[model samples]
Target: MATNVLICDDSSFARKQMARAIPKEWEVDIHFAGDGVEGVQAIREGKGEVVFLDLTMPNLDGYGVLETIRKEDLPAMVIVVSGDIQPDAQDRVKKLGAMAFIKKPIDAEKAREVLTEYGILTGA
Candidate 1:
């Protein structure tokens, strides 16, 4: 099955970088959202099964999106991708229901590991 994925970040560069980092073997229907509001909306619309979410963004932030997802019981696994490597930030996201927290300059290998660990990816 092709997984629906969302990349939510204010920086176009980050979004593109994340898109590139995704393994081609995942068979994802990729979508982009510039902020948390759009990310939440995309989740509501069932456009995302897995989300790569940025912490700091204009209009809405990643935390807000996670909160919305939890409140609404949205069916998307959020993986936080942030420049802030603070342990506090990581804990907060996890408490808010993020499946994983990855620091800035996402590593493709780590990304795959997270997905695989979460049972979102298997095999190749």
Candidate 2:
């Protein structure tokens, strides 16, 4: 079965880059959301089994999305992809419930490693 994946970022370029990093072998139905509000809505609509989220967005932001997910007990795994590489930012997202944080201009190898670590993707 194909996994439902959501990439939520304000930058269209960032979204495309993130999309490209997803392993070719992974079966997924990818969805795009321009901001957190749309991201949350997409999650609720079951378009986001796994979410690649950007921290700085208009309206809700990544932290707000995490809070919404936690508060609502939403069933989605979040991996924050952001230019914010601050340790405090990473800790905050981890505390808020993100599976991991990938520094922006995401690397395909790193993405694959994270996915493999979390058992979201299998095989070598």
Candidate 3:
């Protein structure tokens, strides 16, 4: 089965960049969300399994998305992709149930590494 992957970011450029960064090994039906509200809605509509979420956005931020995911007990693994590389930001996301965090602009290789570590991708 193809994985349903959601890339949520405010920047259209960043969204496209993230879509390209997903490891080709992952057979995914990619979805895009312009903000956290859309991201949450996409997850509810059953398009979220693995999520690439951006920290800064309009309507809502990644943290709010994380909060809603945890609060509503959404069955999605969130991976934060953000320009905010603060230790506090990382810790907060993890605490809120993100599987991993990747800094922007993302390096495809490093993304693969993190995905592999999280078992979202096998090191094949």
Candidate 4:
């Protein structure tokens, strides 16, 4: 079965980059959101079994989405992809229930490694 994946970012370029970084062997139905508000909505709609979230967005932001997911006990696994490389930022996201964080200009290998290590991506 193809997994549902959401890439939420304010940047169209970033979204496309994220889409490309996903392993070609993995079967996924990719969804795009321009901001965090849309991202959360997509998650609630079951379009986001695994979410690639951005830290800085216009309507809600990644942290807010994470908080909402935690508060609602949402069943999606969130991986934050951001340009914010601060250690505090990474730590904060993890604390907020993100499975992992990948810095901006995402590397396909690193993303795959993280997903595989966390057992989120399999047989890809």
Candidate 5:
């Protein structure tokens, strides 16, 4: 089966960028969510096995979503994709059970790195 990925970001541009960056060979099933609330709902609805989450959102920010996921025992690996490069922010998200932290302006190389790190993309 193909790996599934959920992208949650408020910016349409970001979403488009991410869509393009992910390698086609991976055959990933991508799903988009405009905010954390929707992202959480999508996860609950069995959208994906991994989530690309944005930290700064209007409603139910990434932290809150992570907390909810942890509290509810949701089975998904969350990779925080955000522009917030602050050390504290990254640390907090890491503590919240995020599988990885990926900086924004995502590129194909970074996407591949993340997937490989999580064992989602194989064949080194």
Candidate 6:
């Protein structure tokens, strides 16, 4: 079965970059959310299996979105993709139940690595 993915970022450029980074062979069904509010709404609407979330966003940041997901018991694997690589930030996100914490400026290699590590992608 194809894995469903949601890419949530305020920046259109970042979203596009992430979309392009996903391997074509993965057979993923992709979705998008412009901000944390939209991301939460998308999750409520049952958008995808996994969410690639951005930390810095207007109107409800990624941390808020993660909190909402936990509180609502949303069933989606959330992987934080942010420029913030601070230890405290990583700890906070991990404590909130994120499956993975990936640094931003997301390249194709790093994307694939995270996906594979999370079992979202199998094989080459």
The numbered model that scores best in TM-score is: 2
Best of the two (1, 3) by lDDT:
3
> Tens digit of lDDT per residue, candidate 2, span 1-124?
8999999999999999999999999999999999999999999999999999999999999999999999999999999999999999999999999999999889999999999999999974
The true-versus-predicted C-alpha distance at residue 38 of model 6, in Å, is 0.5
In Å, residue 27's CA in model 3 sits off its true spot by: 0.6
Candidate 2, residue 17: lDDT: 99
- As for candidate 1, its clashing pairs are none
lDDT of 6 by residue, 4-95 (tens): 78999999999999899888898878999999999999888878588999999999999999999999899889999999999999999999
Residue 106, candidate 5: Cα error in Å is 0.8
lDDT of 3: 0.93
Question: Which tens-of-lDDT digit does each residue in 28-71 have in candidate 4?
Answer: 99999999889989999999999999999997999999999999
Residue 65 of candidate 5: its Cα lDDT? 91
**Candidate 6 has which clashing residue pairs, if any?**
none
* Model 5, residue 42: C-alpha shift (Å): 0.3
Comparison by TM-score, 4 against 6, better one: 4
Task: Summing lDDT over every window of 10 consecutive residues in candidate 2, give the lowest-scoring window.
Answer: 115-124
TM value for model 4:
0.97
Off by over 4 Å in 1: none
The 10-residue segment with the lowest total lDDT in model 3: 115-124
The residue-level lDDT of candidate 2 at 108 comes to 100
Local accuracy by lDDT, each model:
0.92, 0.97, 0.93, 0.94, 0.89, 0.90
Please give the distance, in angstroms, between residue 83's alpha carbon in candidate 4 and its true position after superposition.
0.6
Q: Runs in model 5 with CA error above 4 Å?
A: none
| The 10-residue segment with the lowest total lDDT in model 5 | 115-124
State the lDDT of candidate 5 residue by residue for 32-104, as single tens digits: 9999899999999878588889999988899999999999999889999899999999999999999899898
* Model 6: CA > 4 A from native: none
